[model samples]
Target: MSTVSTPGEPQARSKPPIEAVPVRHPGRWVGVGIVAIFAAMLVHSLLTNPNWGWSLISEWIFAPPIVKGVGVTLLLTFLSMIIGLALGVLLAIMRLSPNPVMSGSAWVFVWAFRGTPVYVQLFLWANVIALYTTLSLGIPFGPEFFTFETKTLIPAFVAALLGLGLNEAAYMAEIVRAGILSVDEGQEEAATAVGMSRLQTLRHIVLPQAMRVIVPPTGNETISMLKTTSLVIAIPLTTELFFQASAVGNRLFQPFPMAILASIWYLALTSILMVGQFYIERYYAKGAMRELPPTPIQKWRRRLGRGGSND
Candidate 1:
């Protein structure tokens, strides 16, 4: 008996299998180059500017008004962020409102605030010598109108606060809207089906879930707002941190070191904010833990289960 394969039988090839050649991302090389350039520039600049020496550093760092200014900066950053966050939440809800008037009003507010330059907005607000400027309180038509002069009613600091806080609110609103929308619609539906009111559902379920999305960017915004508050110097408020620093620098003619010192404070504040963001993100992600992609063992176990069921 001859051992022969049929004519239609398939033949197997014995060639070695090829593996993928690893590719390094261009971004890594770009990042490395940037670090190298940054290091070189830093070294060169530091070496050339030996006068930012210990004494000058200590003096500027310990200056009474500058020290006080740091406190003011913190106060302003905290107050403005709180104001912005509250406004952001309200604006986001308004933007998502079913009523055309509310939605349109929110849209116009965001568009005007975000579309214009923030610095210009600050300056315009500072110059609020508008005719018939009343010390309006409450809603547009909620009825209590105690009028006062614009200049008397709106101080430079108040104007600056309103400008930056309101402007920040616009950007923050979009961020909040995106964050809330990213949450599963089912969550809201579940709350509704459970007999939760819209406000209650939003306050509890939607907000908790949405927080995971918002916290990170909100932290970043807080950090950015710290630096941005420097723009308040245009309003000529000397109590804020940068203003005091600039005053010292102007008098001493050491603007370079003074500016660098101010930059250092900004860096410090932002670094703290970054750490805060990390913790907040971790906290918000508690319910979102998912097992990572399957390993070989997992793959085989799943396959076996499927195959056994097929039997």
Candidate 2:
């Protein structure tokens, strides 16, 4: 029921709605403006600078030799990574072994490789024929059953692979060991209680969980390996991307431009590897995370959907 107000009494009134103001981040805006200005300036310089020789870069970028070099680079990267990863796993297991001999041997392997410079190692591999003219397959301290010349057996390509792969294995061993150690001791104990052998426990229980740690560094190493393939020049492996680009530059008298072209290719390859690494990390994160993060495509799709609804 409505009530009538008494004459001359004070009247009640409704309060006006409050208007909210967003917090301003002036510092952030200033930083963004500074970055935008620098970026625009860089872009402008790139477009305007004739000395950069963009035309030369474009011309040599797709040349047959360059393409072949790219293929070689990829092959080297893939093979080296395979060697590193496979041997790294074995070394990591050995490092963690109960026996002192196995662990000590693994440690020595790691130490020797890690202590030396890869360039020096590559140089040594290339010149190894000087030290050993012939290698033989036979029982040690017994008559040789078969013999092969070291120079013939270890070519430039083979030397490059050995140098890069063996060096990478030393690094990968540490990475794998760190990943394995990241797994809880309880997980191994539980597996053992359930009648799992050491190998079985590592394979089924520990390694799976450890992958969350392992995949990231492994991905980084893969990308690093791609660039490090450039150092195969120490082996005088002239078929690699950087060496090919430099060769082209020397022939054309435009070394700087060719270097730029090689860099572009490296950047593109590295970007692709980075994307693959992201997905791999996500895959291994399944059990660890409550919800996996969305991919770039998924994020774009969501944004597009929201925009359409807004429209």
Candidate 3:
């Protein structure tokens, strides 16, 4: 059945399509503008400033002495971290041992090293010959089979290592302990139930899990060790980066620019360490995360794909 339309009746109308407006974040844009202004100011200052001695910095940054100094710095960082990590693991195990003597000894060692300043420790090691002119190897308080001069035994480099490595060991012990403690107690119990020995359980079960906790701080400590190599100057050891830069400054009568150069090198080395740390952390995160975060290359590929699709 058809209905007849009334004269002068309004015609049926369709509603207009809804407009979808995105929510605006004005504050975010304001914050970005503020940051950009500050960054521009900083860049402007770096470019315009005449006193920075950018020419001198470029000239000496790759100089032979500076290059050698960087090598020494890297060597010191690697060797010191090795000593610290190895000794720290032993100390941490001792600290967690059932025997009171082992735990007590570990505690005392950590306390002594952590209590003293590193500079003082370096100084003492440098002058250790004052206290022990000769060191002998044999039965304690009995006839010695061999003796050696302390001066010949402990060079300035060795003294720096002793100071830095020993001091770092104390700190690393605490970090290792924290990482060990972060593991679930039930994991160890399950390992024991499987007939694993204490050492085997710790090695296969506990330490592997603990590494997730341990690696981040250990990386940070590695970077700190790189910088702390500067304090070897207190041992009057002159082969490291900072000392070399300072020597160059004194020679050229341009101390401030040389200091800046040292800082730039330190920053560059630290950035490399940070990249390594990121990858290490990502590796350890595999078991913990259901899906790992994208790497830089993956992200770049994704962005390029999106851009091509849009085009």
The list of candidate 3 runs beyond 4 A from truth reads 1-19, 307-311
Off by over 4 Å in 2: 1-19, 307-311
Per-candidate TM vs. native? 0.76, 0.91, 0.91
lDDT of each: 0.83, 0.94, 0.94
Q: Who is ahead in lDDT, 1 or 3? A: 3
List model 1 lDDT by residue over 1-311, tens digit each.
33445566547433445566766688988999999999999898787767765356667786788878888888778888888899999999999989999989999999999999878888888777764466666568787656667888778778878888999999899999998899999999999999999999999999998998898899989988888888887775679888888788888888778887887887887888887777678778878767444545777899888876432
lDDT string for model 2 (1-311, tens) is 33555567656534456667867889988999999999999999999999899999987789999999999999999999999999999999999999999999999999999999999999999999999999999999998999999999999999999999999999999999999999999999999999999999999999999899999999999999999999999988999999999998999898999999999999999999999999999999988989999999998899888886532
lDDT of 3 by residue, 166-255 (tens): 999999999999999999999999999999999999999999899999999999999999999999988899999999999999999999
Model 2 lDDT, full chain set: 0.94
Badly placed stretches (over 4 Å) of model 1 are 1-48, 133-145, 291-311
Q: Considering TM-score, which of the candidate structures 1 and 2 is the better prediction for this target?
A: 2
Please give the lDDT score for candidate 1: 0.83
Residue pairs whose backbone atoms clash in candidate 2: none
Residue 221 lDDT in model 2? Answer: 96
Ranking by lDDT: 2, 3, 1
